[model samples]
Target: MELSVEQAAELRELVNSRDVPADIATRGRIVLWSGKGRRRKDIAELLGVSLPTVDRWKARYAERGLAGLEGERPGGAREQMPARVRSRVIALTRMTPPAGTGLSHWSTRELAKYLARTENIVVSWHYIARIWREESLKPHRSGTFKISKDPAFAEKAADVIGLYLAPPGGAVVLSIDEKTQIQALDRTQPVLPVAFAATGKRTADYVRHGTTNLFAALNVTTGEVLGECRPTRNGKDFLTFLKKAVKPHAGKDIHVVLDNLSTHTTWEVKEWLSKNPHVHFHFTPVGSSWLNQIEIWFGILTRQSIRRGTFSSVHVLVKQIRDYINSWNTTAKPFTWTATAGEVLAKARLVATNMKKIVNNNSN
Candidate 1:
C-alpha cells in the first residue's frame, strides 16, 4: 500500500529503460500505478494483465525490494531477431514483387502475408513496419535527377558560377531572364481574406483576360530587380528592354548571366553586343536553371505576389508585376553561391554515372 521515495524512483527508472523485457517493464509500470493509489483490479485492467499476475509483482516488490522483480523465467532472456530475417526484409523492399503475386511494390501488409504463406514466418504488419523503419527502406517512393547534355555544359556552368562568386571590380553582375506567357487571370468568385483562425481562400476557377511576358534583370551586387512587361518576347522587344536596363549603368562595365534562348542570340542582339564590348554575357548550362539566382527571386515573387493576386486585365497584371519588382528593389541582398565549380562538376559526373547504370539495366 505505500511506497518510499527510493522504491518509487527505482520502479520509474525500470519502466523507462528499453533494455529490459517488455513484460518486466509492464510489471514496473503496474507497481508504479499501484503506488499512485490504483486498485489491484484497475492496474490489471490497465496493463492487460490478470488480477493474480498484478498481485504477484506487487507482493514481490513489497517483500524483496528491487531484487524480487528479476525473478527467473523459462528462458534466460528473449533473443533478438535473427540477421537472416532482417536482411530478407531489406532485400524485398529493394525489389519488385513477383508477377503472380499481384503486387507492384512491397507494402508492409503484403510482405507479412507473403512471409506467412511462403516462409512459414508469422509477423504483424506493425513488426514489419518497425523493421522497414530501422533499415530506412521505402519501396513505394522515387526521385529524379538531371545531368545537362549541353556540349558546352562544363564551360557554361563554370562561367555562370564564377560570375556569382567573383566578378570584375567596378563591373555590375546582372542575372537576366524572361518569364513569358503569365496569364492575367480573374477569379470566378469573390475571395475570402485571411484571418487568424484560417488561411485566405480563392476560387479554383478563373477567367483569362490575356497573357503578357515579363523581362527582368536582377542586380547581383544589390538585390534590386528591374522588370518590364512586353507584348512580345521577340529579339526586338528583348533588345529594347536591355537598352532601358543598361542606360543608367552605361559608363560601368557589366557582366550578364542568362540562358541560351534563340532571342538572346539573334543577329541584332549579337551586333549590339559587338558594339558594346564592355557588356559581357555568360549563359547557364541547359537544364541547369538553378545556377542562376534570378529564377529564385522570380519564384518568391510568384508565390508572394502574382499567384494569389487576381488581375482583371493585361494592364492591371503588368502594373502589379512592376509594383512588386519596384518594392523588391528596396530590400535586395545579393544572392550567395556557396558551392565551388569543382563541387558542382563532381556532382554532375555522379549523376551521369547513375544515369548510365539505369540505362544499361533497362537495356538488359
Candidate 2:
C-alpha cells in the first residue's frame, strides 16, 4: 500500500536528513535510476559506484520492495512447519509427554528431539525457541501451572468483584489479607535518632530479631490500612487482630475478601463469624491470589516502607508499621479496579473454554 501523507512526509525528511546513511541514499537513487530503466553500467557510472553494487541493489528492490533496502533481507527458507505446525506444537505442548520422559510439558530441546524422531522433521533447538515465542508459548514454569479446580469459581468471583464494582453507601469494602512472617531487624549499634540538622546521621548495620506477622485490612474505597502485628498467623491471632482493627468502624457490615487459607476458615473463625453477623467473608478462588488487591498493596508496603527498616522488638516493629500507616492514610490512595467482572469472565471462562476446545479439536 502507498504511504499515508504523514508517512510520506516522514520518509522525505528521513531521506534528506544528514543522519541518513550513504547505503540508504544509494538504494533510493538506484530505485530512481531503475524507474528510468537505466542500465546497471550507466547507473553505477552516474553514482561513481561498482556495477556489482548496482546489480545487487536492483535484485533486492525487485524481490522485497522498500524493506530489503533497509538491510532486512528476505532470502531465508520459509518456515517449514507453517502456522499449522505452530498450532500443532502448542497442542502437543499441553499434552502429557511420553511415559519415560517423566515430563508434563515439552522443553525446547525435548520438543526438537520429538519432532526429529517422530515427525521426520530436522528441527533445531534454536528453531523451536523461535517458534515457541512466535506462537506465544513458554517452556514449563511453576507460576504458569494453573488448574481451575473451583467449579463455582466464576459465580463466586462475580459476587466478590461486584462488591468493588459498585459498593454500598456509607459501607466500605476492604480487601483483607495477611503477610505472614515479616522479619524485624534490630541494629546491633543502637540507631540514634537523627536530629534535623546539617549533620543528620544514623547507623546502618543491623541484626534480625526473628519474625512477626502483619494482618492488614485495606479499605478499597479509601486507601486507609489498619494493620496489626501478631506473634503467629493462626486463626485465634487473626481473630484477635480483626476484632481490634474492626473496632473503629463497627456499625457497618465489613465485607472482607481474603484467601482460602485453613486458618481463615477455622472453627473459631466460623464461630466468630456467626456471632458477628455484620462481618462477612469472601474467599478468593483456590489458585487465584492475583485477584486480591491487598496483595498489590502489601507488595508496595514491603518494597517502599518495610524492607530496609531496623526494629528493636515487636513493639518497635508494630510502632513503625502504625506510623507508616498513619502517614499513608494522609496521602495514600485506593487502587481503581479496572478489570470489570465482564472482562474477567471473558478471560477466565470464554477464553479458557475456547482454548480447551481448540487444544482438543485436532483429529489426530
Candidate 3:
C-alpha cells in the first residue's frame, strides 16, 4: 500500500501528537511505515510489538481506516510462541540438513516444512524466518578452507613464508602465476554505468570472441606488476614470460614464488633454471595458491578488469589487462602476509583434528 500525501501527513501528525494514546500512535506509525513499503514484521520490531499485532493494526486500518484505532486494541494479546518448539527450530538450524532433502543448508520454508511434518505444528515460513533473523541463524552459507596433502607442506610453506617475512637481501622476489582461458565477452547490450543511486548493470547474455591466457609477475618489494597475455598457456609461453620478467633485474638475484603447476616443473623449466643460476624458485605447497601473493593481485585484476569488463576480442582483452597493470603499478602497495607459518600450521592442524573427530563420530 502507498500513502497519499494527506494520509502520510495525518500519520506523521499522529506519530508526533502528544494527545493520542501511545498504542494508537504506534499503530498509526505502523500503518504509515507499511504504506511506505515496510513489512509487517519490521513495523512490529520498530514498534516493539509482535507480528500478529502488526498484522492486526494493518488489517484494521485497511478495513476501517482511522476509526479502527479509536477502540481498544483489535486482538488483545498473542499466545506466546512455544519455547520448546523455538528451541527445536534453533537446534535444527545448527545441525546439518537431512540427507534425503538434497539440501546442504536449511531454508526457512524447508525448516518450516520439516518442523510441521515432524512436530505436528502449523506455522508460517515468515514466522520461522523472523525467528531465524532474531537469532541470526543463517544455515545457508558455509566458509571455505583447504588443507594441502603434500608431504612437504611444512617445508614448502616455511620456505615461502620466510621469503615474505625475511626476504633475501638484494634479491628480486616475484610471485608469478597464470590465469588461463580468459574469455573476451561482449555484452549483448551496452553496460549501464553506475550512479549514486544504483550499481552498474550488465546484460546476462554475451558474445564470446576469443580467449587469452594472462601470465603475471608481482614484484613483492616494489609492488610492480610485469604481465603478458599470450594466446597459449604452455611451458614455452611461461618460459618466454619468465625471460621478460627477469630482464629488468637481470644482474640481481631473483627469487620467484609459484604454485606447483605442471608447467612450472617441466624439464624445460628446469633447464631454464639451470641456465639462470642466480634465479631461485620457491614453490608453495600443493593446492595452496593462497600462499603466493600473486593470487591476491590476480583477484584484484579480476574484479577491476575481467569481471565487469566487456571485451570485443582477445586483443581488446589483452590491452585492458596491460592497461590495468600500468594503472596498478602507479599505486600498488606490497601485499602483506601477517600469519606466520607456525600460526598457519596450527590452524590447519586444528581443522584437521576437528574434521577427524567429525568423521569418527559419524562412522560410529
Candidate 4:
C-alpha cells in the first residue's frame, strides 16, 4: 500500500496518541506497517491479531480512509424496546398490584417479574426503570388528601378567607384556636448536643409529667399572638381567653376567626356574643381548620419550641410556652394568604369530583 505524507503523519499520530480507541490505534498501526512494505503474516504476529483481522482492517482503510476505522461493526447498535412493552409497563405502573401478591404499589423488579409471569413478556428491571423515567412515573411514593364533607364548605371557607384577605376597616381580625392535650415529656436521659457531622440525639423513652391546653389568638394584621396555657380547654377557658384577646382593642369592632368546635359554639359563648354585640364570630368549615391563620402559628410553635423541649413538669412546659409567645410577639409578621375564595372553591369542586368518581367505581 502507498500513502500520502498527510496520511502517514495522521496514522503515526493515531498509533502514538493515548486518547484514540485501542482498536482504532491498532488498525492505524496495521495500515502504517502495510504502507511501510511489511508482510501481512509479520504484521499479524507483531500486533497479536489473527491474519483475517489484519486483512480486514487493511482493506477497510484502503476503501475508506479514517472513517472506516471509527465506527462499530454492522448491527452493533442496541435494539429499542418494543412500543407494546413500554405501554404495558406504563399501564401497570398506574394500577395496584393483584391481590395475594401483597404489594400496595409496584416496584420495578416486581413489575418486570409480574409481566414475565402473566403476559409471557420477558424484560429487565432496568428497561422498566428507563421507561418510568421517560414517563415521569413513581410507583413507590404516595401523597395524602382530604375533601371536606361540610355542606357549607364554600360559604364558611369564603367567610374566613375573606377576613384574612381583607379585614373590615378599624376592626381587629383575630384567628383563635386551642392546641389541646399538649403533653409534658421528660427524657429518661439527658439530650446529647449536636456535634460535627452529627445531629443532636435524645433517648426515645420519656416520663409523662402532665398535659396542658394552649389557647392562642393571632392578630391577622399584626401577626402578634396572645396565648394562655390553661388546665382544660372548656368553654369557660375559651371565653376567658376571648375576653383577654378583645380587651386591647376596646371599643373597636372585633371579628374572630375560629373552628367549629363544641367549646366555640357553646351556650355560654353565644350568650357572651349577644351581650358584647361589637364582637363577631366567623367559623371555619369542619375538617378545614387549616383556613385559620392561628393554626399556622401553632404549627410554628410545635416545630420551634414544644417538639423537642424536655419539660419535667406542666409548670415548666407552661413557662416555655409563655416565653415562646412573648418572643414571637416581639418580632411578629403577618402570614401572607394568597389563595382567593374562587380558587379554593374550584379546588374543592375538583377534589369532590374525584371522590365521586372513586366512590362510583367502588359501588359498581
- Give the lowest summed-lDDT range of ten residues in model 3: 188-197
User: Which regions in candidate 4 have their CA more than 4 angstroms from the true location?
Assistant: 1-145, 190-204
Q: Estimate each model's TM-score.
A: 0.57, 0.53, 0.59, 0.58
Q: 1-364, model 2: which lDDT tens digit per residue?
A: 2332322322333333344465665565566455545677777765667888877876765665444566643787554665556665666565446546645356766786787788765655545555664565653532233334567778767877888788777776878888887878764442222321224332233566778788888888887888877778888887887787677888997888887888888899899889999888888776555567787777677656675466887778878888887888899788887777787777676646755776576544
C-alpha RMSD by candidate, in order: 17.6, 17.5, 14.4, 21.4
- Please give, for residues 285-307, the per-residue lDDT of candidate 3 as tens digits: 87567788888888678766786
Q: On residues 189-307, what C-alpha lDDT tens digit does candidate 4 reach at each position? A: 32121321163222223578999999999999999999999998899999999999999999999999998788998899999999999999999876666688887888788767886
* TM-score, cand. 4: 0.58
What C-alpha lDDT do the candidate models reach, one value each? 0.73, 0.66, 0.75, 0.78
Between prediction 3 and prediction 4, the one with superior lDDT is: 4
Q: Residue 321 deviation, candidate 1, in Å?
A: 0.9
Task: Tally clashing residue pairs in candidate 2.
Answer: 0
Model 2, which residues run further than 4 Å from truth? Answer: 1-147, 184-209, 307-320, 350-364
Alpha-carbon deviation at 290 in model 3, angstroms: 0.8
Best by TM-score: 3
lDDT of 4: 0.78
Give the range where candidate 2 is weakest over 10 consecutive residues by summed lDDT: 190-199
Question: On residues 246-358, what C-alpha lDDT tens digit does candidate 1 reach at each position?
Answer: 88798999898888788999999999999999899888877566677778787787767776578999999999998888787787787777888888899888866765655
Structure candidate 3, residue pairs in collision: none
Model 1 spans > 4 angstroms off: 1-145, 190-204
